[model samples]
Target: MSSDALAELSAQLPGDALLVGADAVEAYRRDRALDPTAGVPLAVALPRTTAEVQAVVRWAAAHGIPIVPRGAGTGLSGGASAVDGGIVLSTERMRDLRIDRTTRTATVQPGLLNAELKAAAAAEGLWYPPDPASYEICSIGGNIATNAGGLCCVKYGVTVDYVLGLEVVLADGRALRLGGPLIKDVAGLSLTKLFVGSEGTLGVITEITLRLLPAAPAPRIVAAWFASIEAAAAAIAEISTTIRPSLLEYMDRTCIDAVEDLLGRGLDRDAAALVLGGSDDLDPDGRDVAFMIDAFRRHGACEVAETGRAEGEALAAARRAAIPAVERRGRLLLSDVGVPLPRLGDLIAGVDAISRDREVTIAMLAHAGDGNTHPLVVFDPTDAVAAERAELAYGEIMSLAISLGGTISGEHGVGRMKRPWLREQIGDDALEIAERIKLALDPDGILNPGAIFEAR
Candidate 1:
């Protein structure tokens, strides 16, 4: 991009919204993945409002500069990776939010953090269900961009399910509001849904309308440790077949050890797998807790423990901390592959095989009931041989998931890192259709280039 054009665009946005120096822009180059091949952008634009965002997009479009829409930069995938000589359009300053209690919706800017939105909803006796592990740091806009899922999503649904409306600035700098607070409107194509998981390829989302539900009841927790991974997988499958718990999570011995190492918690390091089940049913006598306890014991649980509210939350907190805890082991290549409910055990077994074959340390964790797993590949950057193997194992895990009639990515979008295998999972015809739609919305190919699809 020409410096003249960037200077003009910089002048239009607020002083706090522009980062042009090399040092400042360096921090925006990559998200959680820390992609070594990420490029250096010409500038990073932090727009505080929709109009400022439109100004930056319009300027970038006129100059034919690619724009990467970024949120809190907490993405595990390289969805927010900067492009060479391009402009990074960050939503960090667009943190405005308003809660409409009567409509049961929250009108928010994309820059707001997921936890911030949840806390605001809670103050009004409402709830936002999609609680990604990084919810505390990840932005609501980033969550929607990736269609994020969490433990609660097994029963409450993913980010797309909560989204009601969006105000997006198209590639041509035209801002359009697709839907509203009225939930049942079948007015036209589901454009709002289209943007939820678009990964910023089509347009830059400035505002979103999210549906909220009444607060869930305090959960009763059930914890179980199994002797083998197969037994734990069988228990998860059986539990899914029976009742739908509010939260169902799994962590292998590797992950349990990592968390224990960091937190000094009394995690069962000898167990092959740990399963946690939570129920927020209205029944005061705790029928859901009783059911889960029975389910775990019947499915060969080595040990089962049921607890009241405080202990239950403590266990859930540990589960949520699994990612960061595991990160301390080494640099991580996290996989979010998912499979059919019946093939959940097969998928886990397949990953285990890959781990052993590649001779790499792979820590496994999952929202087990939903069949979504995060298999973290840990490797040292300085060890060339191990790094190469880790990279190969990363692709192999996705390949294994696809072979099992599953997705290469379940919650995370097919960002730059996973784009290579996207075509193999979704055939040419489906890819063609997606490209057509992307072209129609972003003919100039200025928004978040190299994300889901290649730049036109």
Candidate 2:
């Protein structure tokens, strides 16, 4: 049956579109989260156009086979983990884009990388502000799938905010267009946003129309190093509540040391935590920078510095590289838990307690202004007991976030890794309504069967 289905799909797609065999399908199995339970797919379908995507969906629907929609496979939440006997639908080949200056929007195919989109917009003297840490490699389609937030999200907003429209291929091969460049369309049920963070459960995004802004001045940065984690956290809480920073981020001692070891950039390894704050406001008085410095001093920051353009950019880049640098220490169980700005300090303290209790190395970092943190739980894969403890700590961190009136996932979507805790975060009534919507759209549960919602 698998062989026959592969043949049918091959016949319908372009000659090089359908790939079978273990060697060809291996790379499509797992995303960045590297879910160990990810299954070997029956085939991978690389579609270059919307019609081809629709055709692949139709074929999978007819066979009642699951379809895992993947875009660049850079997702950190295992949202694109392949399923057994399913078809991996990759949109990496569908790279098309057009920037309309008049409309202040860019219409693009789902496969286009976020960096590529930004460059295109920059060439036209426009800017697309939603930039994830992996913006250089992560696809725009995946950003929409997770409603991804980033460094600039502290002020500029996330992926969903910039999305003006989308062309999605539904489970039954029907193409649906929602919203457009006009910006003020309230004629419908706001269905476009419904699919933004759906994690591919409802449909496959074929194309997107993103809102753009006129390019703004680069931000000036303030860097602070503290002798205590609580001090740094207190400063972040103060800055977040008091001012709107273009960027605000935090890194614990483990993260700072890891990054310093990797880059040799003279970072203070003895510091308990490092905080970076930025302001792009046109004010010449540099009020935000002064305010941040004062807050840091008041919170007992050991050392503080206001940097110029080159130095500031370098600092921001180091913050972005925190994840990969820390990963060099050991295998990681990444967590994306977030809370209200006022509770940021408590969340940090709770995570620290969990790490100590579990005896696991959790290198913490965050978009501090928005209270979204990425705690990299490091464990030696060779040590079974250590791995188990790390897993426990991972879930505990999410639970801690929930206890603080936060979410299990801030931007990475509820993917398989976080699915177990989704119910606890959202409650039964909300989950049921979400499940009903999933069934109403993809009755067979073919589109990303085990991503946001479980396969029935």
Candidate 3:
């Protein structure tokens, strides 16, 4: 990472495409994870097109500098954390999108924000379903990178479900278009699927072809409050067994108080847990809603009621705001661990026990119908002991999920922070195969080094 080399690399692209200077480079050091171990980079590259991205990759290949491809910096898994003396390739300037009404597909550059895509699709009476909590801020590229899942994913499916194609620039700077707008194409290996959640390890995705659905009916919502966490978990498990909810979310009391404190949203802070169920089926009998209400009461709900669209959307918005609200208390070690649907209660209960054992305040929330939960361990940064405990609690939650035959991450990719535990979950044989595949595609080991796997 010599200045001479950076100058040469900078000269390869347009003057405005490269970012240098201490402050500019520093700003790109961490994503939303705020990974403490993130390093300073040599320079940042803001490529506006696939050709510009190829120029950067070619220059990096010539110089052997690690390249960390970054989206909107909204990632939670430290997947975009900068590498020391490496190149930070920012796709923020690559925002180009086109919607094909006849094909019902969106061909977009990596930098388009998820909300922008949704709005663009909505204008044409279409819908793009994978709405992660950070959809408003997260880029479509980031969503594809992590295979991001959202509230309505229980019904519509995750990011991978919508990605129909991709144009990726490989490690050797060869741009390959993997798939197309065709609904079903098994012509070759599932290369498009490989890149969807690859987290920039295999290649840099410049464009995406996403499948879109016709607009759905406006959802009706239900809010259920429980006297005990167990009761809420029971209700979620029961409802999941019977009905496929458009949205099923869970928030523990700690999260409730945090959201209330932040937004003054009048959340029921006294309740042990709050569960929300949403449906868009347009069934005149409202069968799903009725079933959910019955399950809540049977599982000992303190109060259960169906609310109007306004209040329901507001509550859902609050659920989406949980992370930022809880962050106001202290720095958070966020854990996205999920278990089998039937073991959802066990996972939640285990997280609680870990928090108590480690003496940390753990605020919990989930896309409950899918059994994926975010258990946030909060601690003051200045308190070294507390931070250590928070880290321990975070690991414990992931390990507990593993013990229950679950994944360490349901949507957030296993970035550097979760890499150590990845082998434990996938086992040595599977990890070895993944490493072989990684080496096969990225023989130079330059693409997003030390991400899903260690730097070669």
RMSD of 3: 0.8
TM-score of 3: 0.99
Q: Where is model 1 more than 4 Å wrong at Cα? A: none
Tell me each candidate's RMSD, in Å, in order.
1.1, 0.8, 0.8
User: Mind giving the per-residue lDDT tens digits that candidate 2 earns over 96-197?
Assistant: 999999989999998999999999999999999999999999999999999999999999999989988999999999999998997788896989999999
User: Which stretches of model 2 miss by more than 4 angstroms?
Assistant: none
Tens-place lDDT per residue, model 3, 385-455, is 99899888888887899999999999989988898899989999999999998999888998888889998
Q: Rate the local accuracy (lDDT) of all candidates.
A: 0.90, 0.93, 0.93
Q: lDDT score, residue 27, model 2?
A: 96
Candidate 2 lDDT score relative to the true structure: 0.93
TM-score of 1: 0.98
What lDDT score is found at residue 6 in candidate 3?
Answer: 82
Which ten contiguous residues of candidate 2 have the minimum total lDDT? 1-10
Residue range 1-456, candidate 1, lDDT tens digits: 567877799789877778987999999999998877799999998888889989998898888989999999988889999999899988998899999999999999999999999999999999999999888999999999999998899999999998889999999999999888987988878888989888999899999999999999877788999999999999889888788889999999999998999888788899999999988887877776788888889889999998667877777888989989989989999889999889999989988998999999999999998999999999998999999999999999989889989998888878888899999999999999999999898888888888889866
